[model samples]
Target: MKQPKGVFVTGIGTEVGKTVTAALLVRTLKADYWKPVQSGDLNHTDTMKVRKWAGEAAGTFHPERYRLNLPMSPHASAADDGVTIQLQDFELPDTRNFLIVEGAGGLHVPLNDQDCIIDLIQRLGLPVVLVSRHYLGSINHTLLSVEALRHRGISIAGLIFNGDPHPSTESIIEKMTGLQPLFQLGEMQALNDECFERQVQRVGQACKTLLDGL
Candidate 1:
């Protein structure tokens, strides 16, 4: 098999479908996925959702290196758990064809006392795939996020417009920011087994095409 390039999946904010989009990318690339630090996972719901989306069994799913019970920023969660989140603790398998590292929240989210999420992404030194919603303020959030990544010297693979309701923002973002909206995931009323399978398949195909150049 060919070696896969590493891609970091991040979002403008929470509930922007970062994990779902990351799972679609992973399933499309048939690559390894890792979330270095996960917060607010009462019963590992987010990880499990990604696993199911990637069509991987529990054994195949890679566990997060740091799992915090608190549903807040890594800094807060770690503090609540009486532990510290360290970038040094996160490790990537060097042998995998491609590794997808998913962030917990938007850029600048505090991971520790001194470092934020962008610091972690910079540490990984991987290209980014930002996921944004289609609602208002997306333009501001997306542009700022992209600018922040560039300022940190991180390459952006592309953007995924998750839950884009208005079609105008698509062209607007591309024109203003020069970052193409790779995929605009439509609405899904339910996430049942059948819907999940369909969603994965659709996103998988779209990701394969969007990520072809990378």
Candidate 2:
């Protein structure tokens, strides 16, 4: 299989497991990881989490461009920090290795007054690997996410279903989007090297397919 290219990792909404999915991709593809704008949790940011869980298979763990103190939306958090996030403030880390960029929240998440996460994804020019988890409104959220990305003419690497499987929910998403189902990951009770390795084995092939297609 060809080396999978880098991808932007986004989700249906916040707390939908974008970091975990990004770590999984990092382990599966042996790729570098980046979270450009970390709203909060400076001590243990998403970059650190991916590094911890992804283990040695991961390449480089790039630092965040904007590290806000509050755990809120980028715009709100940046306001508290006395910083204004500009679209030009971000630049892709210089790397030859495959990169897994984990976005702060959903595609519509606002980074500043003029731009949102989707705008940043567009600026980065990487295909998205959308992370979706089964929940009450996930179907609507997932479909809307797909629609938004498609409308922007951004390429999507594939869809990743995280957390417990709801076959019926998963089916409709697939049926409606006709998106390539990369893999499904169960909730990780433990975040450790052992757990990451086991999950990597489960989705390794699909990760390769994602890379090859990209």
Give the candidate number with the greatest TM-score.
2
Residue pairs whose backbone atoms clash in candidate 2? 4-211
Candidate 2 versus the native: TM-score? 0.96
- Estimate the lDDT of model 1: 0.78
RMSD (Å) of each candidate, 1 decimal: 2.7, 2.6
lDDT of 1 by residue, 1-214 (tens): 4334778899998889988777766666777777888898667666677777777522235678888898989899999999988888766655546677789889999988899989988877778889888777988998899889988889888788877367787788788778866767777677555665676666665667655767
* Residue 42 miss distance in model 2 (angstroms): 0.7
Against the true structure, what is each candidate's TM-score? Answer: 0.88, 0.96
The prediction achieving the highest lDDT against the true structure is 2
RMSD in Å for candidate 1, one decimal? 2.7
Clashing pairs in 1: 4-97, 40-70, 40-71
* Candidate 1 residue 209 C-alpha distance from true site, Å: 3.9
